[model samples]
Target: MLRYRILKLRGDCLLSLFLLTLIFGLILRIISLCRETFNHEPLSKAPGGDVEPFSLLLIVLGHSRPSSLQRLLNSLSKVEWLHSRVDLRIWIDRGSPRDSLRVAKGFIWSHGSKIVRIRKVHYGLLKSWLQAWPLWDRHDYALILEDDLEIHPQVYQAFRYLTSKIGSRDVDGVIFQRLQDIPCGSFVHFASSWAPVFSRRVFHDFVGWYNARRTCVPGFQPFVPGHDKTYNHWLRERRDVWSPWLRRYLYEKGTVFLYVGSLGMVHNHHERGSHQTEAPAFFVHRKIWPKVEWNRIQECVLQNSPVFECNNTQDGVQCGPVDGDRRALLRRGIKGFLSDKLWICGAPRAV
Candidate 1:
């Protein structure tokens, strides 16, 4: 018994020391990565002239298709950070292919931090997406990038401009999809191959409303443009798709997402997921992307950029020209959006 206790004590000491080293080493690695990726770029200045780097948060979701995942990682590595550093959180769904885990673990981020998690139980896509994104995080902006798309080098630049430059007023989310450029920007209501990114405020409201109304999802109708169902209602039948819920939240809240249909920051590599392309939309401009004057980022203001206002239609929310309804957007806040019924819906579920 005494010998066993002695051996246990030594093992505990070694374990503690190993944990300390790992923790401290991670801290050092973060510092090193920040300097390597961020310092070389021109830092954005705060009003007080304090230097701050633009921060990007990326939530990458994958299950299988290791080659697709690898292609994405390679593009990420090649991206020009511009004024931002990345916080990459890759969450692979449960029962993922063996090659997927190996691919995720092998890739390293040049800038900022990267985390890879493989769940033990099979949660499919919806649970994995809902659970992976934390309510609180430290980043200037965030995007949910799908695994099957290859990113363009200037993708981050486009994201920063769209969200911060224009989206600051009301564009709560932005997405890339295959579309013939509509004169007015088309709102992406479902799965897009490149995927969507919700602003901090919009996402918070979505989570709040979703938690409250989750139980009512059976009867809940998504407000997406031509958002529909077959046999089982959305959340019940389509466990893999989560955007419909978000669409429901946005419809009630009356917010919108702006996307330049012609500009594909990400190219779809596979036949699966939400993409409408004979070839991915990005391929159209890939050859001239190099010659394209990035100065257009500055030239394109709210008027030129596709800004959408939601209007009620027989089908559902329709994206059209700017209308009076724009003011009704998230200005109400989550507290205003929740109701007694919604709060009641959550109570029984909590129990």
Candidate 2:
């Protein structure tokens, strides 16, 4: 009887081991499939698949700094697919002299490639993109980047995924997933355009929108919001204004809204002396401008003016041209210390 019991126990142990091996095999197979599906395969590094040609419209304006520009170029170099095929359009700031731009050209050319085209336009941070309005027909998608962003290896994958998911809709904008606001407790997800990929139709919509309000939000306005400033306000205001329209228009057109980069791989560095700068030393306190009163004032201004010029004055005295020059110096100095810090990344700094 004891011998019979031992034989039964051995049989049970063998069966358990076999089951464990089978389960392990299933897990490994699932992992392999997932790896194949989600792993980035740039066209330059892709396997036996038909190469999809992607034309890049990269714009760099006054925001360009040497360290930041170097970082941008480095990250862009990792884009395996569009190495030689990139149709770059660099719009240097008008304030940045021809000599500065020439130096920029030399810097860009040193990277084993040349910018397919270079256009010098009188554009600040926001005006840079505004200038591209006329030239939107040059590509499938427009990549509007500041000089300080270093993107991830999977940047192309994210773009392709967005294009596939969003389709050819007019209102469908792909948000390139680098955000300062933690919308939820997650590694990555999409909400809206922190860095947007503009399609042709969407570009037109932006132009139309800009044209309609361009008079109010003119290019040279001192208070013209930076990219993050615009994004934050757009998010806060879009639920009542743009979001529903986007959902209806894109959804009706069979395109879905998507965001990528939950891992924060797209790093936005605010190099000092760039076009993006914070308020003067005095504009950093909350008691000076309470949120409730500030919102009320903002609503009043938006409703009353819809578009108005910036107040480049203090104590009823014009700060004049010297203010801009002084601010430029401050901007350059701050860039080195605060390049990748969140204090100035996703939203307007207190000012």
Candidate 3:
């Protein structure tokens, strides 16, 4: 009987231990759910109201190159003028190396910049741009820079000058870098992925058009294949034919994209790209503005009112001189030529 009693006691003890373990597991799961809920609380509820007037959103598109990304970030950090006003958002696409994500997060924390959402799934260039478009709605201006580029020291000054003139000028956006093959011009003839600054209105319009047409064309994939001449040929044709219509639309609405001639405010350092392999000779041969030259230009811009003039050599349209017959041209249609040599000559010469 005593033996039987001892066996019953042992069984009871085992049952109690099982119940205690199950309860503990349940408690841990509940705690985990609560922690997740707390971490994901929306930014709107977290003490910050509306965005600042001069707020700038810097969106960095990062892939698997942690070292390259670190260099870009370091360059940006050196720009004291930009550091305070700019909030950085680094989007780490799926399949990116774990090291890249770690580096990006560390940079953000070190800089005290708020973490923008990290993407889990891989969205190629086109889709990622589309997905990130909504972020512009919250900020006054947005600057998109790929990981492979570095900003010039005077970029912030240039941007400030542009922002100051934005109210009076019908400038929608500005490309900060000069392409190697393309001659320096105010109007962009081709679609460029180089660092471009866009105002809220420009961002909205461009993304709207992109979203509508990205899937409209059949069998035209958004991803550009490396070493595939056929794909490149198709892309060129599409841009040359269909893309101009979008430019025309923006032009008709008094929104023109502009670029600084010859004065490159950013440097492209990528050796290889998804679409094409860049020769080392290409970057070596590219003309870059020296620091002293950029300083002189900045001084000139700050001293006098910056003039927006059309470049007859370039195919795209530009803002005409403030006092010229070109105003009439703008009123009449998107295509107009200003034949005033004095107005063009009086504008700041590109170094």
Best TM-score goes to which candidate?
Answer: 1
Candidate 1, residue 117: the lDDT equals 82
- CA lDDT of every candidate: 0.58, 0.41, 0.52
Question: Can you give the lDDT of residue 10 in candidate 3?
Answer: 100
TM-scores for all predictions: 0.68, 0.46, 0.57
lDDT of 3 by residue, 1-351 (tens): 999999999999999999999999999977754443233222221012221235456788776666667777777776645334345678877877787687787874333234545677877555566565454236556778777778876676566554453341444567665543333333442234567777766677666544544455445333221213433444555532222333323333334455553566788776443333453312333324467354444432232233243321233333344343323325423232112112221221111
* Model 2: lDDT to the true structure: 0.41
**Model 3, residue 316: what's the lDDT?**
33
Q: List model 1 lDDT by residue over 1-351, tens digit each.
A: 999999999999999999999999999977875554344445664322334434557888876667677777887887776544567788887766888888988998866667788887887655665665675464545678767767767766665665555545455566655344343244433333256666666666667776656556555544343444521244455445666665556545556566654465667655343322243322222222352345554444355443355333445435545443344344432343363234444432110
Candidate 1 residue runs with Cα over 4 Å from true position: 1-42, 45-54, 162-164, 167-171, 178-193, 215-225, 229-239, 270-291, 303-319, 328-351
**What's the residue-level lDDT of 345 in candidate 3?**
17
What lDDT is reached at residue 286 by model 1? Answer: 24
Which runs in model 2 stand beyond 4 Å of their true positions?
Answer: 1-54, 82-84, 97-100, 107-121, 165-171, 179-194, 215-256, 273-275, 278-351
For model 3, the superposed segments whose C-alpha errors exceed 4 Å read 1-53, 108-112, 166-169, 179-190, 214-232, 236-255, 277-289, 292-295, 298-351
Clashes of each: 0, 9, 0
